[model samples]
Target: MKITFLGTGTSQGVPVIACPCRVCKSDSAKDKRLRSSVLVQLKKSNIVIDAGPDFRYQMLREDVKLLDAILITHSHKDHIAGLDDVRSYNYLQKRPMDIYASVRDQETIKQEFSYAFREYLYPGVPVINLHNIQQGIRINGADIEVLPVLHMKMEVYGYKIGDFAYITDANFIPAETMAKLMDCKVIVLNALRKEPHVSHYNLEEAVRVLEFLRPEKAYLTHISHLMGFHEEVEKELPGFIRLAYDGLELDIPNSWSE
Candidate 1:
């Protein structure tokens, strides 16, 4: 299986407006990040996690022509705003793509993409078949499961798609969720910055999760400019846990046994 990091920036994305930080102005392409999202491909089937505002740009950059499904973690705009861009795939396949999310998020989608849900609207608008998933639904043919997590006070979600698990926009993962993610070979978590925020898991908190979860490897995403230079913050992390940047690709096994 191969996974691609589409975007790694936090809600505001990297290079915060008007702030002339060195990392923001750096020439290295690694410093640039769009909103956090990922694409997973298993042979012919393709799955995308979160369709933030940069979804269009991410698709264009990767030249993606088809996708089997889209999994949403929450209703946050940065995570679901770009959902409309899936029309390109719908247009090409002449079919609606399967969309999986919690019931709460489904309501959010109805409000956010009311045009797409108009029933008898534009034939060209993207059409999605909603599949409301709760805590432990298997992903179609996959043995993997979804684990709901608490992002501080509000509830966001994390997905365990076999051996690879992704949890972004989360500050806390309760014991139950942690238990579900125990054996993951690769774990991706959000690390917004060095300093603690009210909602997000800062770099330190992410590190703590890495330590507590003890996955084979951990990758950090959903970053903010507050996290500082990619290389710099990465240097401080343990070898088992690395920071993820846009366009990063990794090949891993399916722990959930396909």
Candidate 2:
């Protein structure tokens, strides 16, 4: 499977409105990040993890032709706002895109895009098949399994597919969920910034999680400008862990090989 990092930045992204921080001002392309999102391609499957604000550009830049499904982490605006953009894929593929999310998150989508739920309310609003995911229920066709997590008290989900796991917007994963991710060969997770934050994992805490989970390789994403230079922060990480940048691709072998 080829996993692509569509966007590596946090909610505000690297360049906040008019902050003009050095990381934002830097000419290096890696420093310029969109919101958190990823595209995973395996065999004929083209699944996206999170549909952030940059959904259009990510697809166009990658020349994505068709998308089979979308797996949402939570109902946060940054994660689900670009959901309407799936219309392009729906038109190209001539089928409805299956969206998998928790029941609460599905509610958020219905409320946010009321017209999409009703056929007569608006035309061309995008047709989507909603699958409400209950924790620990494995979807057979998908190589991935949904691992529910906690962002503080709120329930969020991270996905484990084959030997690759992608976890974003999660502050903590309980002992059981952590065990599930241990099966991953390459782990992609959110590491907000250098300092601690209430709702997200800071760099130090993220490192601890990495150590315990012990994936062969770990890449930090959902970064904020406060994380500092990409190169500089990366240098501080252990050899097995690196910072993920947009368009970064990694090939993780199936766990059967391990």
Candidate 3:
């Protein structure tokens, strides 16, 4: 399976509007980030995790022609705002996009995009089928396991597919979720900055969790301009862990050879 970091920045993204931070002004391309999101390409299906405000551009930049589903982590606007653009896929695929989210999040989606849920929908509206996430839910042949964690007080979901796991917009990961992540070969976690954050993990905390999970490889995402330049921050992490940037891609075997 292949994984792509569609966007790695926090809600406002890198180069935050009207901010003259050094990290944002850096010349490196890695410093330019969009909102947090990822694309997972499996043997028979392609799925996207989160559809933030940058969704359209991310999809166009990647030239994604086929998409099977979208897995939402929570109801936060940064995670679900660009869902309206799924209409492009609906037009091309000639079917309703299948979206998986928690029951509470589904309600929020309906509220946010009430036009799509109307009995008599207007033309050209995004067509989507909402599925409440549950055990044994599979997209095509890929089995997805939901990892529930906490974004401050709100419940958020991380996901495990095969030997790859992804978690973002989280500060507290429950013990049960940690157990589910133990065997993952590759893991992605959020690290907003060097300082402590109330709803997101800081660099130190993210490193500690990755160290405990001990995945063969770990990546930090959902970064902020405050995290410092990508090249420098990366050097501070363990060799097994790296900071993920927009457009970063990874290929993982279905199972470890060992």
Candidate 4:
């Protein structure tokens, strides 16, 4: 399995407009992020987790020609805003994009993109098939396990595919959910900044979770401008943990491969 970090920044993205922070002013490419998202490329299909506001640009930047499905982590605008842009893929693939989300997020999708659900759809509207996630689901020949975590009072989803797990926009991970992540070789968790956040994990909390999970490798994502320079934060992390930047790629053995 191959994973690509499509966007590693938080909802507002890096270099928040008009904010004069040193990390924002830095010229390094690693300092630039475009909201949080990931592209998982499997042998039979390509899946994108979250389609943030930068989804279009992310797709264009990566020159993606075929996308089989999208797995939504929550109803947050940053994670689902770019969903409308799937029209481009619809045009090219000549098929409705398969989208998996919780029932709550499905409601948000309907409310936010009401036009798409209209009986008499307008031309050029994104074509999508919404599937409400239960415990887990299969798509494009891959089975994905959905793990529920808490984002403040709201429930959010994290996903486990093969030996990889990804969680974002979360602050509290229940013990049940943590159990699902035990065997994951690689895990990605959101770390909004250095300080505590009501709806997201701070750097320290994220590291603590990583330490407990003891994954072979753990990456921090969904970063904010306040997270400091990527290089600086990276230097402070343990050997098993690293800061994930946009466009970072990792290749892992596909257990399903024969």
TM-score per prediction, in order, is 0.95, 0.95, 0.98, 0.98
lDDT of 1 by residue, 99-132 (tens): 8888889998988899889958886777988887
Candidate 1: where are CA atoms >4 Å away?
138-140, 256-258
Task: List lDDT for all candidates, in order.
Answer: 0.86, 0.87, 0.94, 0.94
Alpha-carbon RMSD of each model: 1.5, 2.0, 1.8, 0.9
What is the C-alpha lDDT profile of model 4 across 36-105, one tens digit per residue? 9999999988999999899999999988899999999998999999999999989989999999999989
Choose the strongest candidate by TM-score.
Answer: 4
What is the descending TM-score order?
Answer: 4, 3, 2, 1
| Model 2 misplacement above 4 A | 135-140, 256-258
For candidate 3, the per-residue lDDT at 136 reads: 42
Over 167-190, each residue of candidate 3 has an lDDT whose tens digit, in order, gives: 999999999899999999999999
**In model 3, what is the error at residue 117, expressed in angstroms?**
0.5
Higher-ranked by lDDT: 1 or 4: 4
TM value for model 1 = 0.95
